[model samples]
Target chain A: MDQFTLNLIVVGITFALYIGIAIWARAGTTAEFYAAGQGVHPVLNGMATGADWMSAASFISMAGIIALAPAGGYEQSAYLMGWTGGYVLLALLLAPYLRKFGKFTVPEFIGDRFYSGGARLLAVICLIVISVTYVIGQMRGVGVTFSRFLEVSTDTGLYIGAAIVFAYAVLGGMKGITYTQVAQYVVLIIAYTIPAIFISLQLTGAFLPQLGLIGTHTASGVEFLTKLDQVVTELGFRAYTSDSPNMLNMFLFTMSLMIGTAGLPHVIIRFFTVPKVSDARTSAGWALVFIALLYTVAPAVGAMARLNLTTTMWPAAEQGNALDGPAITLAEIDSNPELSWIRTWEKTGLLGMSDLNGDGQIQYFAEPPAVTAANKALAAATAALAAAGPDADRAALLAEVAAATAARDAALAEATIGGVSLAERGWVGNEVTRLDNDMMVLANPEIAALPGWVIALVAAGAVAAALSTAAGLLLAISSAISHDLIKGSINPNISEKGELLAARIAMTFAILVATYLGLNPPGFAAQVVALAFGLAAATIFPALMMGIFSKRINKEGAIAGMLVGLIFTGVYIFLYKGWFFIPGTNMLADIPANYLFGISPLSIGSVGAVLNFAAAFLVSGMTREPPHEVQELVESIRVPRGAGSATGH
Target chain B: MADKSSANAYWAANLRTIGISLVVWFLCSFGLGIILRPALRGIHVGGADLGFWFAQNGSIYVFIVLIFVYAWRMNRLDLEHGVEE
Candidate 1:
């Protein structure tokens, strides 16, 4: 069978398995629907949380981002550290305590802790906003995966994805989502590791990618990273292990992702499914183990893929000499079986190439200073020719353009690698123009010439990653709406049966909104990720931390802190990323020079979180202390004893 | 239920464990991975330096260990303090 058939079979089987799990685990009551009856095994819950946490971005885009970074994947370590480190904070500071609080939703804890309905409503708003923004990305990822692998329209794929999530989510709620996510974790991890293992073995002759990353390259007999550093730097990129130019921003960005990861409602809710606070703590450890399995392999995949691409274009780069080898010729790209992945990706418009100098060879190198100056002169001469009317001085203007072109060609020919001039072979500017980051992972197996089934498994894995996270986020949003908003305050008299129906209705509504947004996403759908992380980091995380840790933090303080953090982070992001992400509405251009203290908006969440803590402390110090009963609640949650099944009251 | 003083001591012990674990966490990722990276660059691990390993691989391992240690220590503390569920 062809590759498409293989993809259909693998993806179809995964989908059937998820729907079957949903049916088998159908929830019976609000307890089962919302918190999986508080009986999930810590290990199983950890696996499910891993699936819930590793979205399409983690599975499909992270390695690509690392591979394409200018600092040879070093600058991208912020993501690797930031995402995993947050679980430390979760397990140590947040998860066990929250599990002891024994509530169905995050807002429930906030509302009760603060002893205010409005505070609960604010948390609900933040949860909804964060989860909705996050889910849109997942939905879009699902659509993209389907359009590429199954050859369906993005919209059709989104509808299919929404339907699958709805069947599982709306039908089985947390119980179903938990089990399906466990299965998803299995599929995605297998799919991700198989490719990395193959590529690692091919590059370094090491079975374990973790060891392969540091092992010697079998072909060059040099250290893997040392060889990668030599290859990338020879092509005008920084060494793979170089430090980030801006260390402060890197620190803050990592902190923001860490705080944001802990604050995300969907992830935090996973801990509520376990029986005891101790289980909650250990579950976080297991989740990290599962997540680390992928996180540790990603850098290896990135470095190896980068080495592979560079060597494919410049075959002699690995041997410490690039000038001796001719660039891969266009004719080889057309007929070489190994280069076939390029053609497949080109159809998706994620990869492109052009023979600009028409030398039959496709040169993929950074332009030297002289070539840049020459190209500028050529552009000026060409423009002058256009300005002078066709009737006047046509011959002279044409001659001037020709002279400029020759000068540019001379500059290109003068460029040297390994002290050998490009004059021996006529080459021009870079030809591999558009290598989108998504292609690094999506086309990885094919680039290494792995089998069709491996590629199919990858396709299935990407879809599973997108769908599992989408379901988790949808559950968070719907639960906030149904359990917190409607039942907690709006209709306190809502029966358990009535609340379950409301939860189902809310879930259906949330899925419809997500699908609609996925189908017709706002232009800034990608940019709003900063908004999601910012709000979660600034508003939700600080609030939860303080609620448990500080007895002096009264309702007024918590409310004040969340509002201040939310507005500060939101406005700061809007100032740089456009108001509500509308293009051109930004007050300042988003560049390092314009950034406050060189902290990009993406890294501003840490600052906002600080301000949140400050505001809460200042406000609380000036106000009355919380009631005696509230103090008791804090003391009780701290002990982790007497924890019971989640209840509304 | 335990007396208030015992409860307070248990809380203090938990805080102490947390304080120590947090120090390790900060040192591994932010300290060694970023700030002290250049200082530790001379010590090599395979192809890269100690700092690169900390940034990409070592810190993650430390984080995993940190959580399990905290959990194990906290569980023991709970049992010793008559707070175990």
Candidate 2:
């Protein structure tokens, strides 16, 4: 069967499974809506948490980011490190304590711990900001996956996704979101691994991608990394395994992501679904285990995809296959059945090519701006020499130009397989300017000539990942509005049934808002997620930590800390990336040259967190101490004894 | 007889364990994985250098182990101090 129909069947089956799980696990009360009645098993909760935590960024974008390293260094490893490391912080420092607090939402914990309506309101604002920013990315991801696999318009794809999530999440609440997420985790992991295994076997004669990454190339018998290093460097880019140019930025970026991961309200609330404090800790471990199954394989997928992409454009004749004889020409890319994936992606406008010198050959290389300038300068010099009198040593000047061109050309020829230059390739500018890095993974199986079913599975997996995380985030947003805002504050006397209705309404509103943003996404929705992580790391994380770990931190201090942290991180990001990310409204140019203390906006959250700690401590020193009862509450939460049941108050 | 002193002792033990475990976690990701990565560059494993391995894979492994160890040891401490749930 063709890919589109197969994709529909696979995606349809997964959607039906999700809806079935949602109906079976439907929430019956406000508590179930908020916390799944707190009866979920540790392993199950862990799997759900994995699904919630690994958003579109984790599934569709992360490996591509790590692989492309658009920043041209290994700095992207920070995502790999920081994201998983946050779970460590959660499991040890935050999750058990929060679970013990027996709360419905993160803001409620802050509200109760601080003993102030103002503090609770502040926490709610922060949660909404972080979650809303994050949900946009998930929504955009859903649109992309829908558009690609289902062959619908981005808007149509988004509405379909929003409708599916609305059905499951509104009906099931936390219970629905949790069980569906488990199914998603299973689907996403299998979908992720199958392709990696196939590609690994083809590339290195190893079935395990992790082992394959470190193994030798089956055809060339060279170690994979060594071959990769040689290939990328030949294209004038840094070696595949090289370190980032700025170590400090990488460190801070990783730290921020880790802290942010721990503080995300949706992820933190997952631990509350499990029964006991110890279970929260164990669930985090299980979550990490499931997460690691993909995280560990991601680098292998990244490296192998990078290798495969380059090799596809520049076939390796040394392997001596019939298709390995020449670099891909523009005409062949359009006509060759083997090159059909390129045509499919090109229609999305994410991939494009041009024969700048009219050479009719695709020249994929690095430092295009530099090469173009140098080539122009050489041509001009040669022309001027020819324009000079015949007495001028034109022969020598021409020879010098020829030699320079040959040297430049030699790199591509030596680095690629078969050493064949497609039509004197050196003068050609980089053929493809619109090679969207995000398309790498989705296009990988097709590039490697894997079977259509595996490609269909990838479509299902990407949608599952985006939907699962979107459901979790929508749940958080709805709960915050219902549990923390309306029920907790506006109408304390609201009935349980009334609150459940409010929760569903809140969820529907959140989905509509998310769908609208997904349709007209703020530029590069994923980058906005960095701002979300920053906000969470800076404001929410410190507040939660101080509320648990310190008795002296008063309500005034917590509120002050959150405001200071939020403004600090928000302004820093806005100053660099536009004001509220409105494109051209940035105060400073978004470049490393203008960064504060050499810290990029991506890494500024760590600094904001430190500033929060300092501000909270300093402010608390000036204010009266927390009330005696609040102090007692803190002390009680610190221990695991007599942890109250999550149901029936 | 599990009064304030015993409660205080239990908290102290938990804090101590947390402190030590956090130290190990820090060393694994930031220390060995990033700062000390350059020093370990010559040490090869599979296809990557030791530092790259630590950054991409080893630190995560260590984090999972650290959390489980913290939970198990803290549970034992809780029992010793008569604070088990």
Interface RMSD of each candidate, angstroms, one decimal: 0.8, 1.6
Best by TM-score: 1
After TM-score superposition, the amount by which residue A150's alpha carbon in candidate 1 deviates from its true location, in angstroms, is: 2.6
Best by lDDT: 1
Candidate 2, A127-174: lDDT as tens digits: 987888788778877777776786656677778878877876786546
What C-alpha lDDT values do all the predictions have?
Answer: 0.83, 0.80
TM-score of chain A of each: 0.90, 0.88
Stretches of candidate 1 off by over 4 Å are: A151-175, A318-320, A367-427, A491-531
The lowest-lDDT stretch of 10 consecutive residues in candidate 2 chain B is B1-10
TM-scores, chain B, all models: 0.96, 0.93
Error of 2 at A488 (Å): 2.2
| Candidate 2 lDDT score relative to the true structure | 0.80
Q: Tens-digit lDDT track for model 1 on A1-649?
A: 9788899999999988987997888776545666762677778878888999998878877787788776568878887998899999999889999999988688988999999999999999889877876776677677667766865555776777787778766765466767888899999999999999998999999999999999999988999998988877777667888889899988998889889888999888878768888898899999999999999998888888888888888888767656567788888988997787777666665678888778888777665778778878998999998899757888999999999999987887788644545555555666787776756887888888899999999999998898788777877887788778988889988887787788788778877776776665432222234347767999899999999988999999999998898888888887986765555688998878999999988788899899999999999999999999999999999997788876656
Candidate 2 chain A, which ten residues in sequence have the lowest lDDT sum? A414-423
